[model samples]
Target: MSGSEALDQGPLRVLSFGCRLNTSESVAMRDLARRGGHAEALLVNTCAVTAEAERQARKAIRRAARDNPGTPILVTGCAAQLRPAEWAALPGVSRVIGNADKLTPEAWNAAAPPAPVSDVMAARQAAAHLVTEFAGRARAFLQVQQGCDHRCTFCVIPFGRGPSRSVPLGAVVEQARAAVAAGYREVVLTGVDIASFGPDLPGRPSLGQAVRRLLALVPELPRLRLSSLDPAAIDEELWRLLAEEPRLMPHLHLSLQHGDDLMLKRMKRRHSRAGALAAAARARTLRPGIALGADLIAGFPTETEAHFAAMLDFVTEAGLHFLHVFPYSERPGTPAARMPQLPVPLRRERAARLRAAGTAAAEHFYQTRLEQARQGQKETVLMEAPDRGHTEHFAPLRLVRGEARHGAVLQARVLGADARGLLAEVA
Candidate 1:
């Protein structure tokens, strides 16, 4: 059958919700369905990071059913893990699978599922599996691990996703090669804890080794990036690999929930603000001019004035380029939700303060870049202008008064900042 005819035979309309890891899994699953010639109607890959996440997942499934009224619904992901009963009972949901075995076809067809999906794992929590062998896309991700071993008091992930898991390095490399061959320009190594990849295997190759092996396998790819990693997961070797690999994107999105030590402890996080700073420092030293992004939870239970002040101070001093601020939300079955809850008024106040701070912090970062460019520091930019590219710094420069080839990094002379990006002249 022709490829188009094959797709028509059994079309699985895939949808996804949740974190990057889940999104990656959905893409992998969709590819499998397409290749296998079996289609699903609105195969909803739902997410449930927070309670709102669960609500949204339901909304997504219902919307899918509304859009494709006659299609079947497949519900899965974190939302499925912690709330299988709710999902399975949805109007059009045909099957609901938890993190345990949702990625595989057989596991997806399991007759029975857990209600809350609290406590259970299909394979060894660390069993290395790659489900995207025949997947095609402009870019693809390899889910190297699943579940979190860390039972942070504020998190329901442990109860839902089980323990830390890792995929085998060989399977990961092979899948990456296949994806690259399928015309994917980039391959992102992703997971619930990709930093924990290779642990399921006896050899326990470091995250760096797994990435380097994949790069070696697909040396022709234009880009290779990583999903977020726990700040505590890196080491000297990882830093070294990052420094040397030009193909690796110059971005390190660290998980820094709060800047105060007390708040971090309250959240049951493994790393301290100091620890996060130290890692950022090391990464900066290894790769100068790298963009460092971070996650910040503005308000948490029991956070005090002193704690918030400390956090604000740390953020200003950290020289972080960008921040993703989230106000604390209580998720069911997590310890933090039941802890002495912060007043809604207080949470709103802190969120406002943090939002203002984020603006100032970002402005300072942008102004700093302007100053550096003024100092005659020219950087190579990669042109992303479909017809153009920008520098390594990602300063969007116009093709401007000259013919520039697509995807070539050329020295750009910064004109000045505008509502657009770094307006520049091709040097």
Candidate 2:
């Protein structure tokens, strides 16, 4: 699980869980709650990606009630959206807000009644919320799309997020502009299925088109990044952007659930094993030395030992530098949940193996980076903290000398390498 955090310095505290999109929404919700006079409330933005995620949210809710006494706890997010009554019955939860109304002004009004959960599947249009601040974050997560249209057999997110929707290009530019104006050196475009962006809008512009326009319109923005992308859905324009746009960071994280062809088909993933490999190859050809990452599920229903072995080898074959490995967690109401199940211990064991492979891959990639650094190659580092930041390829870097300020972008030369990241000095 991605770490959860309390946003803002106001009386209204927000605990955001799960994805960057939730974090972005939490920032907006904090402002809305303050403006609507809900200062004494604690908002819990929950995630339903895994059963463990939901368990953590419930644990947090109980802890918040025990520690804070009478502070009203408001629960919302994919978890709460999927199971409103379950969350509402928890101690100290005064309201259970759904995803559809969580950002609306009325939902946070102190005088407003508890709003009924709207049908997320009926959400036709996604409106852009101009979020200029990210509290403690150096990079801003600018949401350019929302919801999902695909129904992967093992996933339940589409039900919670609804149909695919795109925030208009003009509004996206405005938000990017606002984020850049607010001192963010990097802006990550986030959404549920961002590659599916723009088909719902006028002229049906692709994600590539929107990104190209965003870069063109905001020349002041130093670096732009993207959240997880669908390998099957990447368009020609986006491939060209990777080849040509220097401002676009050279890191691509693909939503590749599994590497085995049969496993991918069972997971209802659109891209096959060969197709995924081709995508990785294309990315490398377009952007030399590009770092590739993927979301891989370790164990799925009916996954044989051979299938697991193939997936483990695929990581090395694809040259994946980063991996988000999830042990198969059965979300009820999903197709995979009904299939023959694997033992929990076995699933976890496979996850560990996948992670081990990923670590080895990362170490190899870092060694190459270190070699480049030793050769006096320079890298642009975005300082997320005083002593640490990340390179353009999204590798963690540490400043061994030369003072660095948070949110400052500087060119640096690598001095050394370690297990965690690179050691560098401002150049």
Candidate 3:
């Protein structure tokens, strides 16, 4: 083929998988590819948050190889971090770069070791790990930090991601500008620990400082969102900025792994249920009615019935918008993994109860919003369901008829709570 023919081939499609933290690294990878004069490489960013996610990621790899034959594949992110060896053995994978290489300055060099492909079928079936980045979404995330220092016994992330490290602030600001110019309405500031955004950096300008710098870079961008944050990471300045910034999403996702103090201590997590409660209260005081969500591990080792009740009470009183609940899964390496295991039956019971609590909390928060909507509170819902787009808040406002456009902020009048969100008809 001629040089012109190769040049017109296409941009490299790179995909990353996992939470927002991985998204930042993947964005860095895309930048590296673009600057090196190979802007045509279409980077396919993929995700693998669960076993299903892993399976789907592998599926994407195979699909990519088939659709674009001879493409040099780069497998990366948490899946890479956790199972680099497994990916290295897969067919169609030109490079099996893991957590280490994904973040390296040269993410898409395509000049690395090739896989052996000894057992092509085995490699193909192996799962894709969690990737931090998301591609083709309206928003992009800048992962400022990686690795969770928290030793939550139910979590395998600390093991998979290793020690926490912050990306240089200057680089982050530059990345944010590029993303904004690319037409992403929003950029999610993400990381394994976003609150620890600049702790490893000299002077640690703080997560708030980093975000303020980002806004300063692309003030025109309509919105920016911060991913999960530990209550311990919150400070007065952070909430104050959130209260003042219109571009920043009024969404604070606090990680409340468990509501019981003793269970939290046993998990080696930093915050107590009381501490989490205080943090939520602080956030509400600053941004009243701001959407606050959280995560909860339903059952930890040594969690008694009383402990579960305490967790339920805490969540109920705290008024969380929603929660992502999980039955504690003991990974191969972790302190809780060695403790006297809870029977599968009990784990199921505890998880179900916590789920109920989560639903009640979500409903209560939703109802509060509904009441406000009834009283003529203006809700700028991203009209999606009845043929349009939706909100980053992720609340479903049942399919309603109107001129609902993707990205169009609708002035909705709340009818009542329907199957969707605060059931509102477009006004």
Candidate 4:
């Protein structure tokens, strides 16, 4: 979960939750609110990825109401999209807007209808918002697409978001160019399912084609990165770019979900255990030592000890450098929720085990990088702060002997490793 404020003293305050998409949308909402003259509004953009996420959003809303008396709190995003009346009924909530209307200018108008949440499934086309500035970050997230078409049994995102819709190629390039103009060193192409990016477009371009074009058009853009991707849906053009494009960052975060084939089937995921390994192997082969990250779920319905063990082993086999582990949260109305459920304690335990494995793998990878740095290898670091930043591989780097301006990209050499991350010196 990520949170941000429009301005320290600005009249409108925005609290965003969930994925990068939500963060990008929050920034847009803040801009809309300011433009619409909603000076006393407090916007809470919520998420429904898991039950805990919704709980946290509710908690934040209550806290906001308690802390700022009489503020008109407008709730939006996935949680509100799914349950408008329920969220609108909450104390201090002035209105509940759906995902469909949240980004539109009309939704922010003071004279708009109350609780305006339309059926998300009815949405087909997704328009690109020219969001160049990301409130307080070095990297700008450019949403190239919207929603998800696949219905993974353990997921509720599709219902919260809408069908997979691509923001036209021209719009994507325009946004990337704008981000570069705004002095953003890095721009991450984010979406609900980016791998499924282009069939809806006129020419039916792939994600890789869009990327290649963006890099070409916006040659000054230093680095380009992608948000979480679906491993099973990677196209040939994307693979080619991975092997050739220097501007395209090497770090890839895959939405693997689960490692066991049986569990994947139960979860309605497209990739198998072997398919995931192949994806990782292909990535490393194309971009040697490229950092690999995965989103894995532990204790899915009917997952046995053997299944769990296989998943643990898969982590080591795939050489995953980062992991986003989640304990299975049974969402109501999902197919998995209707299946045989795993004990909540067991699910949490398995999640911990997966996280530990990921930690060990990441430490080992960092140590390897540290060794290379000792050998006098240099890395391009994008400083997110005066003394901290990340490498092309997305390794957290902390400068111990030098300082650089935020958003400055420069070469640096790693000096050592700490519990936090890599310690480095500007070269």
Candidate 5:
């Protein structure tokens, strides 16, 4: 049969991009597509976080079409939702499904779906799509919430994701249990605004409460981690988890967009420079050796050198070991886009400088850990590969072959360091 004919009766092959939340949703799309009898179609689950992400998606669509020949291609996710007509006009695309409609089973069927997705801003809740396994990985992502309530001027996700909504607490626990039963050693609770979890649910349980309940109910879950955290939203329950929960991994990736007060205000962020430092210090105090990571944007509208300098200083002051840096990209319709803009080249240059700082901080943190290793400290490592695993502090370690089996949680003694990761021997 022709590839298109086969697609009419077969399962879907999903190409996922972007955040862990997108990864989680892709699994559901595949399952729904299979049940809907379009198992043979190819779905491009796109990301629109940056212009580059969108560019890659468009490139991949053409590549999928070229490689698959007669196979039908379908597009969805944030990118498609944000620019439905743009995706629909692409050469190989047979249908362009919106973020909200993609989860419904009927939308996955071979029949052409409805045009231009309903206004995503009108969306009240994120659809609940349960996934049993993570397809190919040892770790799985469980989505507890969807969308964002915050409207940071530089961000486009809130519009793409809609107003904040959360999955019920009981539903979250059930999903965690399923993941454990499926043999996943680690499960990450992911969302566009994970910190805002429970506000829409009854009693408005905080993210901390959700984590506490999940860990308590799923005792067998080996490791639980969070995808991203907003600095202003760190609650007491989360602090308690850091202090007492051994199963909770000791890594936090913070959403601290800018370090300068004026830039922060312009970005519409809730936390201040001092507040971020305090939160990081508190986390470390509660869990000694915890590694802190952060997301930083290098250039924004009206950003001066002094503003950039404050951000550069904030990295070291806050002692951030890992950083995700982004050069501000102007998305259409955002307030920041209309502000006095920075030179595109300058934005990229600043981003590069921030990344360099991040590298130095990472190297310094690694050296400090190695010092502890020399002093005979050991870390609990979760083996992702036969020769490598990540420590509880989220540092990668290379193991001596045959020293520890894959998937084994071993007390690995760090012997020394290399450019990529720490070299270790099973203790």
Candidate 6:
């Protein structure tokens, strides 16, 4: 699970966990729940990325039930999608909605809901739900794609998310335009496997095509950002956008789960270490100041110390500015779980080492930029909070004090660095 939060009103509260896609979908679900007059209920949007994630969701459900004894608790999202009955059987859960039903308003307000889930693989298209607002986000996320076509050995997401599908280009443009019209300075294109977008579309358009079209069609949008991307899937058009589209933010978070070639192959990943390096290099060459980030897994099944060492080196080689290090946790049914397993403690230890390296890399990047800021290099930041924002390169910044407005872009001469982030005052 990526994160969790609670939103409470008179009748409806939502507890959401997982990715930005989930966050966007939760906003849609929130609207549906509010409008359906189920606002008094508690909805838990769960994640099933790891066994720990499911455990956390279950724990959260129990706690929510204990805390709000009178409130009805509804469960949904990836964890629920995979095991609807399992969640339904939980003590506090009054009802369980599958991934397919989570966004459907009728399901939330049904007189009596049917069997909560259907054959997910049989569902072909992504539901095109345009969320008008993000309750507590600086930018609006537009989900242009959903589901995954590839089945990696270590992942259960494909089963939970269903087959790869794209929201039609027109719908994407309209959503982006609406977000810009609604006064959002930034729009992030999000999805289950965003880089794998458009294969199921009419023209077999690439992710690049959708992004190019979105920018062209919604010229008023000040900034466009992307979610996690597969290294092998970035096309020529995406490269062109990286080079030329100033509005396209200069940061790419890659879905490079590991660096060892054997581990990557065993994991059924398409890109190799060399390919990942090449992709990062190409992105950097195209967008000179672009920041690169990636998701890295430590201690995958049968991963040796040498293998992990290679991964640690790859982080520096790729010049990664951000890192999401996941400790390998065995999900019961995945192919990796059936393979030779690493001890849980060992996996966590490796993860900590990787995270420390990632932290050092991030700090180095911040310190370098802090020096540049001290040298009078002006940075423009979009204020997400009254005192917090991030740079275009996706570096976090904390305002020391200033006339700040949420969602407004500000030019600031970063004064110094701190544990919170870059300490800055308006230029």
* Candidates ranked by TM-score: 2, 4, 6, 5, 1, 3
Residue-pair clashes per prediction, in order, are 19, 0, 36, 0, 5, 4
Model 5 residue 233 lDDT score = 94
What is the C-alpha local distance difference test score of each model?
0.67, 0.89, 0.64, 0.88, 0.82, 0.85
Candidate rank order under lDDT: 2, 4, 6, 5, 1, 3
lDDT of 4 by residue, 1-427 (tens): 3233443337677887787788788888888877767887788889888788888889888988899889999899998988889999888998888998888888888776574689999998998865555555888888888999999998888999999999998988888888888888899998899999999999999998988888888899889999999999999989999999999999999999888889999888999999999999999999998999999999999999999999999999998989999899888899999999989999999999999998888888889899999888888998889999999999999999899998899999899986667889989
Error of 2 at 160 (Å): 0.8
CA displacement after TM-score superposition, residue 407 of candidate 6 (Å): 0.6
User: Which candidate has the top score in lDDT?
Assistant: 2
TM-score of each: 0.81, 0.98, 0.77, 0.97, 0.93, 0.97
Where model 4 places Cα greater than 4 Å from the true spot, the runs are 1-9, 130-132
lDDT of 5 by residue, 1-427 (tens): 0001011223467777777677778778777777776746787788777777787778878887898877778888887888899998987888888877778877876765556676777887764455544443557778888888888998888878878898898888888888778777888888888898888788999999989998989999999889889989988999999899999999999999889999999999999999999999999999998899999998899999999999999999998988889899888888899999999999999999999999888888888888998898887887777788888778888886456666667888887876667888888
Better of 1 and 5 by TM-score: 5
Model 6 lDDT tens row, 1-427: 4567666655678778877788779878877777766757888888888787788888888887888787888788888888888898887777777776667778777456545577677877776666545566788888888889898899988889888888999998888888888888988888999898898889999989888988888899999989999999999999999999999999999999998899999899999999999999999999986889999999999999999999999999999978999998776688988999999999999999999988888888878888887777888898888888898988898887675888989898888875446778887
How many collisions between residues are there in candidate 3? 36
Q: Which residue window of length 10 is worst by lDDT in model 1?
A: 1-10
lDDT tens per residue, model 2, 151-235: 8989989988888999999999998898888888899999999999998999999999999999999999999999999999999
Model 2 / residue 332 / CA error / Å: 1.1
Q: What is the per-residue lDDT of model 3 for residues 365-399, given as tens digits with 9 covering 90 to 100? A: 66777787778775665543344344445555643
RMSD of 4: 1.5
